[model samples]
Target: MLSLSGLALFAGIASAYVVSNGTTCYLYPESQIHLGRNVDDTPSIHQAFDQCGTNGTVVFTEETFHLNTVVNTTGLLNCLVELKGELLFSTNVPYWLSHSISVGLQNQSTAWLFGGTNVTFLGQGGSINGNGQTWYDENQNHSNQPGRPITITFSNSTNLWIENLRIIQQQFWATFVTYSHNVTMKDVYVNGTSNSRWNTVNTDGSDTWNSRDILMENWTVVTGDDCIAAKGNTTNLHVKNVTCYGGAGMTIGSVGQYPNSPDYDENIVFEQVRTIDTFNGAYIKTWQGETAGVSSNGDAGGGGSGLIRNITFKDFDMINCSLPLQITQCIYTEDAGACETSKSRYIEDIHFENITATSRYNIAASL
Candidate 1:
């Protein structure tokens, strides 16, 4: 994305690799951005972003330091920049910024929202803790006035690579992307420890609501909610070699007039996955509510005709998943809740091979 320019950091740090932008920086073998210092990583990060000629890299040192917000209103994470850090070794953003997001609080963790083409956020077995304990209890009286502590927010980009990162304990969806293409989130570990009971809601691992060329592989997701959620007219997505535990399994089309403004999910692939103790192994159905986001599909779409086609799930092993494979076209109508059911979303060209399951509920495939 970027043309190599003044990459003092990459040039100093490593010799064999690709820099997002042509810009270079020497990532000193021994470097630390102390909490209290005149030197800053944000500037260094943006410097790479600046030189990406177009794309760049943001590498974090092995230190726990607070950070200022790297804001991008264009809904893009600058195509050439590379944002990486030495995981568990370096910490950034000690607390959330109140002025940056919709309802940001001190402990909110989903602080850094990133998206762009040719962008990579790689870390070495480190943790991006979204200290969600501060704002976990906003139920009736308040909406999410408290910001969701997510690792990254991808919007409208192409060619993304997120690997070897441990994203944990966020207040909301861990990684939420919208309108992007050719994305890959691999070798990623998303976890939600029950340190606080209220600290978990919608902690989705990787959500491709409306995009394509998505690939999520070799991942372990133990979250408070859906491990991987697909929504509204998504196309050409792939989820392979993953293990999901303690949440909803790979979900497609929790459809409720979603895409909020566009096409739905199609051409998805889920292979070599194992699910354990979750709500459902693979779900494809529209929700009941559409007008508002308050209730979880209480009264929704005219029914999905958005084509959940060409889906392939092979070599899937399930153990004790509550409701293993449910494909329902049944719509939840107003008067009866389960009434309107006439070709909701077309589930064509679907194939399930070498699938083994031990579910409390029967393996029901609604065609």
Candidate 2:
């Protein structure tokens, strides 16, 4: 039987339309909110300019919608939008030969990079499922890079909250929060598992770069790639109360640059994290010239500025890990490592506490 989630999953091919050159779009059950299901809502939902405020709450309400193009917000600034839904992949209606439901459910798969601030995606006991098995399976027979299905971008946005949702299999990274601040991701689960063949790749849990004031808690990550990663000028960030089953354990840096620029990172905190059946415990790692790691990404022994500092890793219980923690400044002229070895910079303090490896590749700390 086809996965139930596969049946209910929206192809995610939405196109943004201009609405009287509007500035804000209000949605809720009370207002004249048109959901994605109704033809009226399609125009109203698309007409939303820069902001989609509380004027309405666009609800999927047990429906599957598609978007064949980009959903742009007309370069809106400091805008706020709230989308609430209660959709479950488990509630998929069985497809029958005499079915009324249509075929070609798949939409023109593309990246959905959302650009907005103060946005809230609340799906209490619900999910915005991404059935990525087809994407992963496609890569098995060929040498093609998987397409990043939808990019929910929060560029230069502040006080963003993405909570109470389960993000499933994807063609690429599940969630990418870049250049944003005061972001909180609560009770989120990102999974890229296949019951048959290997249907996962580059399906990162959450990737944060050049951001600050973050809180990632109550997460269950079971991906084939990094569980949660931080990259570039990310400071004053915190990852607490997380449970990661498989993937490269909590990556730090994939940093490296040319005279065009350098790198810097600081003030990071990770606590109460659990690594289960993973490859590494927690990485305070900087990558090679062309490196990539989830938990983090920094250059090792590069002559720019210390890209990492004030790091705190505490109360982490290890279920099964392959490699422990390793902290060493790298030398571009030599091996791969951290950017700051004998020197400290933009980064000041580093702290780690209370970590246990139930099944690991190594021990506690390798700093």
Candidate 3:
């Protein structure tokens, strides 16, 4: 979290609705009249970004903004976003299914594609609500829905600072960072609990893929999926002071999916974390080699090569966790002997230190 005083990008650019301060420009959306309506704020947001997205600030001042369309605001330069309001997505299943932006990762899509250089976002108690109960009830079997958008995505960007942001009931993963670098998020909260009979599936708190130099701390995640997952080509990720509930704690991979593409993840660390009623405090799951298929849950993978190296999970407090630490190389494979016989992904220099876990099972870990 960076203060406005610390912003050093002094270049000035102003427009009709954009105002200029000492070194920072500001744009307050003029569409406050459309608050809480069926009207979309995506165009207003795009206008503000186009006007004051470079060396400036965009202030979301309304109490609530209803969005029913896709939002893609990227390539901003040295901007700060002040969120003093809520951004709520509509539950039009058919509309979103056709309009969500493709992320090019395992049939995933996103409601918003947000990224930029030197972008700093400070959410002053504001939130992004996905209104996921609709999706949950629609997809009753919890199967993967094509074009079900993640709440937000940071992609193809650099130098992002996001703080004090809350995401509730995301349609899919709360946040996904891909092909980005030098991203930091702190004091973030995520909740994806379902109030209906249908479960909230695939609602990962945060996931990173093809990214580097990421730092996440002081996050509280309540979801049905991974709290934080590092997918293929993730490097130098350090997550600390995280508290997870009812999720797959901290995870590395389900990688090694593409047979031709090599998965390389290295220098990952998750320290001082707390998991309650989670599947595992920390785990690494890689697909078995010489195999390819999709699972019942619609996760398609297998037959890939890779190396996971220099990973550490330290100082974890796991309460009633199934496995404190797990390394499964044969995930998604039915053959028990295939884990040993198959040419699987390689793991080296892995360490689990100072773990205090009370597993429901007798075995503390499985490797």
Candidate 2 worst ten-residue window by lDDT = 100-109
How well is each residue in 240-319 modelled by candidate 1, as lDDT tens digits? 99999878788776654542443456778888989988877777766432233333332224433456677777788888
Question: Candidate 2: deviation at residue 134, Å?
Answer: 1.8
Candidate 1 wrong stretches, greater than 4 Å: 1-22, 25-48, 51-57, 68-70, 73-110, 137-149, 258-262, 289-294, 297-305, 329-338, 341-344, 361-367
Model 3 steric clash pairs: none
Task: Please give the TM-score that candidate 1 achieves against the real structure.
Answer: 0.73
Candidate with the greatest lDDT versus the true structure: 3
- The digit string of per-residue lDDT tens for model 3 on 1-367 reads 6556444322222123344554444544334333433666677678778867888888876457777789988999999998887898999999999999999888889999999999998998788999988887888846568888899999988999999999998999999999999999999999999899877788999999999999999999998889999999999999999999987899998788778788999999999999999988899998877555665447776778889999999999999998888998877778676566336578999999998999989989898
Number of the top candidate by TM-score? 3
| Stretch of 10 with least lDDT, candidate 3 | 8-17
Report lDDT (CA) for all predictions. 0.59, 0.54, 0.85
Q: Model 3 misses residue 342 by how many Å?
A: 4.6
Candidate 3 whole-model C-alpha lDDT, 0 to 1: 0.85
User: Any runs in candidate 3 off by more than 4 Å, and if so which?
Assistant: 1-36, 141-143, 297-299, 335-344
Least accurate 10 contiguous residues by lDDT in model 1:
86-95
Candidate 2 lDDT over residue span 70-129, tens digit each: 344423344544344322121111211122111111111224455455566665554555
TM-score for each candidate, following the candidate numbering:
0.73, 0.68, 0.90
> Which candidate order results from sorting by TM-score in descending order?
3, 1, 2
Q: State in Å the error of residue 238, model 3.
A: 0.3
